[model samples]
Target: MTYDDLLRRAAALARPGHRAILGIAGSPGAGKTTLARRLVRDLGDIAAHVPMDGFHLADAELDRLGLRDRKGAPETFDAGGYAALLRRLRDERGEVVYAPGFERVLEQPIAGAVPVPPGARLVVTEGNYLLLDTGSWVRVRGELDEVWFCAPDEEDRVRRLVARHEEFGKSHEAAVAWVLRSDQRNAELVAGTRERADLVLTAAQLPEP
Candidate 1:
């Protein structure tokens, strides 16, 4: 579908009386964040963007758990916290709600970085494990009105992932290694949950990378 098509569908979810939460799920580098931001930007004040990356555990905590090497894995995030935030966004309690945001430079989650005002009728959230049906992740799907999966070409996805790592200070060789090892594993796991999404989209339907 085109971006305009997606925008119309998102707008439809916020029909007459209720607020809605729309989720964008995909493997690493599949453009979930890009699509979520585009939806929010196109919809303007009616929507808000709340990313799941904000729930990533701090680097020091990852080090303490010996999970620093597998940073983007599902286990590395605060899944329960993410679920709670989604619940709050769904509630739309007539007050502003704060959500965390990830800082690429620091590679950490910054608290209270995103604000969802009371007037927003839609909350656009994107993440890797939104359709994952294990442990704390099971609570996620129940909180979202619908989840869209993004599936980009595998080669392009890998290239984008490697470039992102390099952009954040990793050497080219290290970036490739990480993408092939850690990121690829997570990507494969996320792919398994694709069938559960309400809709599936491709990179072509999103903004140019």
Candidate 2:
């Protein structure tokens, strides 16, 4: 879906004296983050971002658990921690709450990067496993006011994912390999949850440059 349409949908869901949380879920290269950023930008200062990537396990923790190679898999994140943050967001304690954000260059989640002020009108969260039925994720949908699943063409999705890995320092060959193995697996899992989303968005139209 176009970013403008998403923003308008979110705005309608927003209410005075209440917080609105929207989930943008998709495969790794389906533009969930891009859509989330555009929503926040279009929604202006009252909007905040709270991505699920922030709950990724530290590199050390991943190593200890023998999950370093499966970094983007569902098990690699702190699902419970993410759930707790969602709970706090819903509670509306009137105090600013801080959450981590993952840095691609550092390949880790940096603490205190995403600050969700208590009074923000909107919280736009994007991630792969938000709609998954396993673990704490099952309760995640209860916290979101709306959930949109992005589904780009499969070929386009794979190409974007390969390019992203290459841009992030992976060799061309390595990028292709990762997409075929790890990324494709995650994509299949994410696709299975499309039925759970409130909206299924196909973002094929590129905005004019």
Candidate 3:
């Protein structure tokens, strides 16, 4: 289906008195963030964007645990904290709720950077591990009303992933190496969870807002 078609379906998720959450899952550089931001923008005041990148462990924390090399892996995140935030978004409807945001250049998570107001009927969150059925990650899928997985062309995805790393401060060679060694492994894990998604989307299926 086209972006417009998905927009209509997303809009329909909001009811008179309930809040619904839509999850966008995909491998690194699959355009999950782009699609999610566009959908929330098109849906206007009814929607809010809450990206899962916000749960990334700080560099200091990663260093302490000696997991810095596995930065993008599922273990590098505060999965339980993310799950709790999702649960709060689903149940605490009376007041404004704040979710964390990540800074790409610094590669750090900023706390209380995103606000989900009471008026927001739908929350659109995107991430790589949304569909993972392991450990604390398992709690993620249960909170989302429907999860959509992005499946872009492999070559295109790799190109974008490499470019992103470079844009955020890595050298060309370093970016490519990181993409192939680290990102690729995480991508494979995320790909395995695609079948569990309610819908699968391609880059062509998503349009600019």
Candidate 4:
């Protein structure tokens, strides 16, 4: 429906005692991060944000593996490690856990950038491949209390993606080329996993700024 509905749904998950994880899954530019952050911000101290982008493989590692060109593809991420972190976040309730975070300008992951204190009862994790049922990614869903998919208008999504790349250092042409040649392929793959999500949210369903 609207942001109010999402807020209510998220609030219900952050109950007393046990911790809860709310996963937001979608393709690049579908606004998963935007939605996840908004939920955490609105939910106040009970929620913490842990993004999947934080799990991206370093450029050096990608170069060594000959995957430098396919940076945003699922193969370029530490899927197993991401899954393991999710498991820890879900199980380790009392400690002050830390999670990695990604820097868009540097296109690198920063370790221990996010802190999830014991007071945080909910963790909002957003990513592209959370719903993927392949390889180590299959372990992710088991750790989440609920997963919601974001499916925005295609034209708008592509536009935002291109602008994001351009904002991060790519030229307009390079950004367009990357979005069409690489991101689009990954987007299609993520789209296929939509049916597996507990709920699907569209542009109109997201929060109003």
| TM-score of every candidate relative to the true structure | 0.97, 0.94, 0.98, 0.98
lDDT, model 2? 0.85
Tens-place lDDT per residue, model 4, 152-202, is 999999999998998899999999999999999999999999999999998
Q: Give the TM-score of candidate 1.
A: 0.97
Give Cα distance to truth, residue 134, candidate 3, Å. 0.6
TM-score of 4: 0.98
Q: Tell me the RMSD of model 4 versus the true structure.
A: 0.9
- After superposition, the stretches of candidate 4 with alpha carbons farther than 4 Å from their true spots are none
Model 2 misplacement above 4 A:
205-209
Q: In every candidate, how many clashes are there?
A: 0, 0, 0, 0
Model 2 poorest 10 in a row by lDDT: 200-209
Q: How big is the positional error of residue 10 in model 1, measured in Å on the Cα after superposition?
A: 0.7
Which ten residues in a row are the worst by lDDT in model 3?
A: 200-209
RMSD of each: 1.0, 1.7, 1.1, 0.9
Q: Please, what are the lDDT tens digits per residue for candidate 1 over residues 1-209?
A: 79888889999987655689999999999998888888888898989999999999999999999999999999999999999999988776599999999999999999999999988889999999999999999998889999999998889989999999999999999999999999999999999999999998986887776
